[model samples]
Target: MASSNSLLSEMQFLCPICLDVFTRPVSTPCGHNFCMSCITCYWNDTPVCQCPICKETFEKRPDLKVNTFISELASQFMSLQVTDAHIWSADQQKASCGGAVLCDICTNTKQEAVKSCLECQTSYCDVHLEPHHRATGLKRHTLVDPLASLENMICKEHTRLLMLFCKNDQVLLCDVCAISRHVNHDVISMQQAYKEMKALLGDTEAKVQQMIQERLQKVQAMNESVKQSVTETKDVIANGVQDLTTLVSEIQKSQKELVKVMEEKQKEAEEQADEFISGMKQEITELQKTMMKLRELKQTEDQLCFLQSFPNSSLLPHTMDLSTFSFNRHAEIQHIRKSLSKSVSELKMLLNKMNTEIQKFSDDTDVSNNTMLRYMQQFEVDIVLDPDTAHPLLTLSDDGKQVKYSMGSGLWGIQNLNPNMFTEHLAVLGQRGFSSCRFYFEVFVGGKTEWCLGVATASVQRRGALVRGPGCGLWAIWFLEDKFETFSSPNVPVHFGKPERIGVFVDYNGGQIYFYDRQTATLIYCFTECFFTEELYPYFNPCDNEYGSNLDPLIIVPVSRME
Candidate 1:
């Protein structure tokens, strides 16, 4: 039986073209057996008729015949063989042990791995893993699910199971390694480390998602800001265009009126010239007629007759009115042109002022405040103290530029007091007054603890109690008891440091007053939309000396222009 099985296995019954058991086997002229259909299909595809296995050629295709004896022998052998149809296929072999993890102990015929031993760094099948479950020595091996790389489960240096995690070095460690190199480091079991690391990863992912959301919100806000800016810019452009168009129309109207005035003067001059020419022509014709009459009188030889005729003749013209014809030709036009020129000069000045305002709005430099101060300096006034407007308890300097509060029984005891003097409040007014233009002045309030400085209207109370506020015709900023405040409807607190020199600017036409710290050029406070029907004077109040704390005199300083 063994000899017959060996003989059947060694038989060559596969077709070379199909590489499988022959089907309808046929013998070619070269004695090579092949599947009849396989050879016929091969011959039909190629130009030369040849045996596939032997490469033997033929002039005409052979009439192939089946090998009956070989076919019968192959059929008998196939029937006698014990064929197992349920054998493992190639794919199944690869899934089990051919391509997957194989048992290390199954050296003769490798089998699929079932479990892995972390301690031994080896894999084993069910049959070979029995020792791990039975033997006490093998039972100590840490077993887990089958893995391809078991070597990674052991420490390379210590040759021991990596059962611990070293957090300081961020590496895996063994029990022996933990006691040696990682003894001082933070170490924990691998399971605990894995759980902690997974939790941290979750937190990191959440943070990344939150950051993405925040960026998206920022993008949306930026888009909204851009849209609003574009809208506002368009509105500004439209308004500017309208304003320019209106200005051009006004200029054109003024130009036409000026030209009309000049044209009228020119027409009057031409009319005067026509009247002068007509008068001269009539005189010339009368003279010619008189000469003809004289020649006729000479023919009559009578001088007396000629003299009498000349006195009564129509040729003799009456005294002509030359004064009208001798009038200045350029007088009318000159007067009109001068008036037009003056109007144009005023318009030029207005345009220059408008240009300056536009430049102020467009300038983007840090020196804008300084530039404003310099411009305001042109309106600087030399402020002097008015003794008549000062409180009787206040003392003024000889130069009338400084004043301070006097605590004595007052000037009423020494000299006659002015009725207009501030008798209740320790305040004083400047000598000069402004009614319409802008003016700026600075006061040195250094070393003063309590003081007030600003502008006051002419009608401000001078005799009894006084109200220190804008509504009461007083616009001022005061420093009292370490607090800075501005006088308004309701006193407003000013957030500013103590300044040595205080600048006061009053624009009567603009109905505004501004206070500034001269040293830093920083705005301290402003009074806007103030109604001033009378003249305004710079007001100063050096509060009563409280134990000499407010002794420093309120000195009026000159404004220094910045280059």
Candidate 2:
């Protein structure tokens, strides 16, 4: 029996279909043996009956017959190996009892699986997994954790394990897929792709955090601005209320003064009436006594006394002559009325002056236009001449800081005008142009008899007679002869004195241009609500030189700091 068991162990009695000892062994016409049920099932699943091991074909269906001799041999082999198989199974169960994945091969007692083989797409217990670790054929199979869903890790189209990443398609690919459909695509190892994607995710996370911080900062700044705006609004309201209160108090004081004067005039008139009534009453009392004495003398008992009293009528009160008691009310009140009228006129003058002052206060804070210009001087710009835009007759200094008209020698010396020159106007534009900010420049017109200086938009005509007015995109003031004038629609005259150094301020955002006398800090003129759409340049015209009368150059002056 020992000799038979040793021979059976060396013999090949395992079926290729089940990889185990064959049960109910059968033989076909091709002379290959297999389990009867396994052969039938294989043939039924295929188009033709063929041997699985040798690839031998059968032309016709052949009746299967049990190979009794091989069956007995396989039964004896299984019985002999039973003790060793039981021992191996027991060892595998003991080794894998703690794991979650149960081995598929351990039928009698299910045990935990140690590793999953990608090539077989099956999980195996430690005992069954020994083939992958020891055998050369199974050693090359990929192993991983005992995964629950091995199907998810497989390529459905190729029915192969996914082991690569296709960068072109941004998808996971199997080895066969990478070689076939994705051969020309960018592909990388799965591990390498995973590391790169993790790095990218970390970078993205950092950027998102930075963006969050930036937005939070913006929110905080906006909140602060809102708070500041509210605070400023409250302060403005409080100041305005205080000013109005002061004005009201002034009006109340004027009213009291007016009432006091009127009351004094009325009291004087009442005192005059009271004095007239008292004089009339004293005269009446004297007349009543004279009449009582006259009646006593008329009784004839005192005829002599009556004659004596009548004889001295001039000595008694003159009852018939009431001229001394007459009240000239108009004469009494005329002086008071005249005084009240004068007081009213003076009060009206005071109110008028106050109204004018209040109007001035309402229009602008204590700061005058000159003060505003001084404030704007902080944004003063250094202006230079642009020779390209100057008229042919105009000569520019080497430093481009001054320009003056120069007529070439003859009485009517006509110089050839270039296309870039201002043909009809003796105008030159500054080198720098501004479109959206505040800028100021000063031009010295000290000895020039006639000159024009201000800002002009880029669209102003360069070759023809350019209208120096707001409608033509030119906001300017001019000094001609002895008069100062602003080039408005109708050329309004400016009453301000001539300024040797004229400061031109342009506020593009505010749409205004202000002219100032830098020497006296006085405003010459201002062009308000100016519609500026393009770049603005400082415009200067010395007005044809005037036969040496206006020969002085228009010099661009530097702004000086205030003390």
Best by lDDT: 1
Q: Which stretches of candidate 2 lie over 4 Å from their true place?
A: 1-370, 409-417, 468-470
Candidate 2 C-alpha lDDT tens digits along 378-442:
89888887877877787877788887777643332334556666778888888889989999888
Q: lDDT by residue for model 1 over 1-563, one digit each (tens)?
A: 33665565536766788876677888988889888899989999999998777788999999998888777766665655434322335456655663578899997999999998887888999999999999999887778878776798878887677889999999999899999998899999999999999999999989999988878866886788699979988998899889988999999987897788668877887887888788789987987877786677768757776666655545455647666457686786688779878988998998898788678757854357767677777889889888888886788887888888666543323213898788888889998889989999999998788898888888888878876544787888887655579765335677547788888888998778988788887777887657789999999999976635786789998787755
CA lDDT for candidate 1: 0.80
Per-model TM-score versus the true fold: 0.39, 0.35
For candidate 1, list the clashing residue pairs, or say none.
Answer: none
The clash number for model 2 is: 0
Clashing pairs in 2: none
Candidate 1 accuracy as TM-score: 0.39
Q: Which ten residues in a row have the lowest lDDT in candidate 2?
A: 408-417
lDDT of 2 at 421: 64
